[model samples]
Target: MTRSRATLALATTAASAAFLAPALPASAAVTKGLQDQEMTVNQPGLTPAFLTAAQEANVGLVRFNTRWDGQASAPDPAQVAAIKAFATKAAAAGIGSIEVSPNISGDASFNPRGKGRGPKATDKISQDAYRAYIRALATALKDVPVARFYSAINEPNWFRHIPQRGGAILYRRLHNIAYEEIKAVDPAAKVLFGELLPYARPTSKSYPHGQSADPGAFVREALGLTKSWKGRGRTASYAVKADGVSLHTYDFQADPSRKSSKRGRDAWVHANLDWAKADLRKAARTKRLPSAAAKRIYLTEFAYKTSGSDKLSTSKASSYLKKAWTVAKKQKVRSFLWYQLRDPTSTDELWQSGLQTRDGGVRSTWTTFKGLR
Candidate 1:
């Protein structure tokens, strides 16, 4: 994941404190959530301990990630059971599930560099295979009452990620595939759209290795929301569909109130999610997808880096968090999730944005995050 290098450019100096976006009153329906993939899945005593933690924190939802091939193959039955068990327990504990499929559409991998099969992300996913797997997974999980919202993939806007080149068009197709399948299994189920990274590069052009697509371009093309969208893809029938718009943000260097002056409408950032929502609504209107327009924006993943001089000061991180909630509230975001409850084990880890440090210390942002409406 050239993601480390991909985001290095967006690291801007923190914004002025006095220049905050006018904060709106928090929405009463907003459901705060947390995403600690490692802890929620592998934490010891997951039932009494982890489940209790989520219950205590008022977590309305928790995200669970899996690969398409893992469940489809059924080679290791426990892997599938673990997912069902987690959702069942979370439901019992009063937390709903947000399932994310990260990779591998079939029961095999293709190493683009070599013929031998491996986990090197060299080839794209096959939509047909992915659709079949998602349908099965959704049908299997239909028994788990809490397993409802499904996010197709994480960070489709990241550099060199799977389902690339096709950009939003590619991602939209994948999302629609999952959307139709999951909906078939549970009509009440929702397929989240655009688990896109929150950065945008310069306008369309041939790119060097490791550059990200202009997310705005991806979003528009994916939904056929462009200026003249009626004739795209040589068809009047819809190409891709989504129930809700999903975005992931970890724009560490800037404050949430810091809007992209030139790129706001074209891409997603903590500040520009409102623009994305408008796009989703416009697309839904043009496409006549009623269910898609009814969803509130879902900020599925977000965090601020703390502890290092290069990162935010604990106090600043906390301030930024309060501002993030302000942005969310103003945008009427349905869910605002911090990336992880605890930071990775060491500073070397790429995602240093966690509510609690690995050494069992909590940052000021912990209280600020834990208290978000």
Candidate 2:
């Protein structure tokens, strides 16, 4: 998150991979992992370091995000090669699974931050080009047998990744295309979607134009579960389908077990997982869309900020993380990833949640992460 060292993650060729881990016991049903784009992806030389540290903390899985740029027919060959190499190295290190998401910075590929008349409206990558990019990357990985658990994209509900105006509709189209392309490359490939942003404003009106939609609204609209927000519906050429729904469940201001007292509100935070799970179940069974997707869930990214003003500077992350694991088990989460491993020196766009602190030492939360098992 410090923006200097974002690299790759581990991988599995298929379900039959010999490195696949045994299922955890009931008390440790959740697969605890880390999502440090920096330490895992950027610093290959540091692999042995983090691998040892992860083993110390009992982390078995890692999530890596690769930012793909330009309209090249595919992702960068060098990056893919590095990722494949990392996958091999990680598997050798006893890492059980990996999740990779190829993301595009800003709203489009025209420029890093398109903000002009020509760049703003027309900045989007065409459907054909995007399809080709996803297809090529997935194809390349699949050939190497590395296209294991692929996330369609980062948080589409957030304004930073996508323009909030018609954002869910746009993400739905992209996700469906990604699904088709990845599945076309490897029919058995596991594709996951919707690492939705967990934070929500207090009121519906709080999300004005250009601001992001809440996770609940984004899910209903993107999945075409509502009459008003029906996007390229069941009859459309592209339908929404995924093996599991992923969400970010950060509740930094309070304990993860803390619930909102607001009545009739659905924000989809950690405390509202029941609400989130119900929605997933409905989608899995709903006739409006394909019932191919299951009610499975993945908590792809979440952590409490230890130093940020947003966290009020006195929060106890280690304790909350312990409770978070309990909540995850109760909710039957398929995967649980802390947002990052090590913290930056200071002031890193508001995210300071790390099992290891900026001092390059483990936090009490590091033990908390291990105590999940």
Candidate 3:
């Protein structure tokens, strides 16, 4: 969870054989590709470079999560301007869409250990706040043709819960309310679900029985009849289903150090994706979930750290990133997104996943991915 430092450099999004690589035997399909980045509310200035890089990489989408604290009372005008600016820049760059969330885990105040606002309290207030946030966001982007989808929150499953309720319940509840509010204004906008944190650790304190709720487990719980997600039925409304599923993967955390032989990493990717797809398919089969108009997986975030205290060499990071693109093509994932367009805070540990270092320098992964398209 701690991000290390890295040298910053500008990256060019030039396509490579790697980006257009053929499918691997065990991987899914990839259609659209994206890169994730952190942008603060009211910082619309950063959108141009991000869209430019995304266009260079041939990726059409960018993912960013909104912090509830920043927009709880009324949506921050600066943040609103930033999103609109992103859309304008993306359209000029010919990038496809933007995904935004309200109930994301960025604000420390909302996080359990940070300010102790706790997930439950945050969830309760944020859920209501999200309706307004999404409404306003959608309204702002309404004229922006480049934008495709909007989300209410980032990863709700990681939020803490009260004694009786857990993160899954809170997540589902928020999604339900948010979806209703979103569609009430804009029915055409697509909503994305399932932005689960990639790795599931056995030591995590966020799940039932303390067994650790990985992405799969979170999905299982959401679809489980006994769970009563969102303090109501396990089923999500049709409006919620209108949005496609969203996901991010980073095997580095699961198997850092490139220590896991290639075979092992491939196996891990195969298993994780297979399990997720199977579960979604099962839900659809049981008629418990709506069928996706589009059925490919979207890897909203994926990267290997290349510098700082825990730096992987540039060569190794590039190799890892290439392998991920290869696997995505093989897996037939609808689209894959690299972690970031720009590195915001050098102090923001997670920002190390960026294609560029904090100072705006390129990592090897950045070059490799540029050629991927």
Worst 10 residues of 2 by lDDT: 8-17
Model 2 error, position 193 (Å): 2.4
Q: Which regions of candidate 2 are displaced past 4 Å?
A: 1-28, 69-72, 107-123, 143-147, 201-210, 227-238, 262-264, 288-294, 312-315, 345-349
Q: Of the candidates numbered 2 and 3, which has the greater TM-score value?
A: 2
Superposition error at 262 for model 1 (Å):
7.0
Rank order (by TM-score, best first)? 2, 1, 3
lDDT of 3 by residue, 1-373 (tens): 1122111111112111101112211234354455443432223345556666766777656655444442364555555555555554455555655666553323333333322234444444555566667677666555555545655555444442211135565566666665676677766566667665654444334332332245655665665532222223434332235356666666663332233343322122433565556556655654445667225466665666654555666677786666666666765676676665555565545445667766668766677888884
Tens-place lDDT digits, model 2, residues 236-257? 4335777767788776666778
Alpha-carbon RMSD, each predicted model: 9.3, 5.3, 7.8
Error of 1 at 108 (Å): 17
Q: How many backbone collisions does model 3 have? A: 35
Better-scoring candidate (lDDT), 1 or 2: 2
Candidate number of the best TM-score: 2
Displacement of residue 264 (Cα, Å) in model 1 is 4.2
What residue runs in model 3 are displaced by over 4 Å at the alpha carbon?
1-47, 70-73, 103-126, 160-164, 204-212, 225-240, 253-271, 308-310, 345-350
TM-score of each: 0.77, 0.81, 0.73
Candidate 1 residue pairs in backbone clash: 216-266
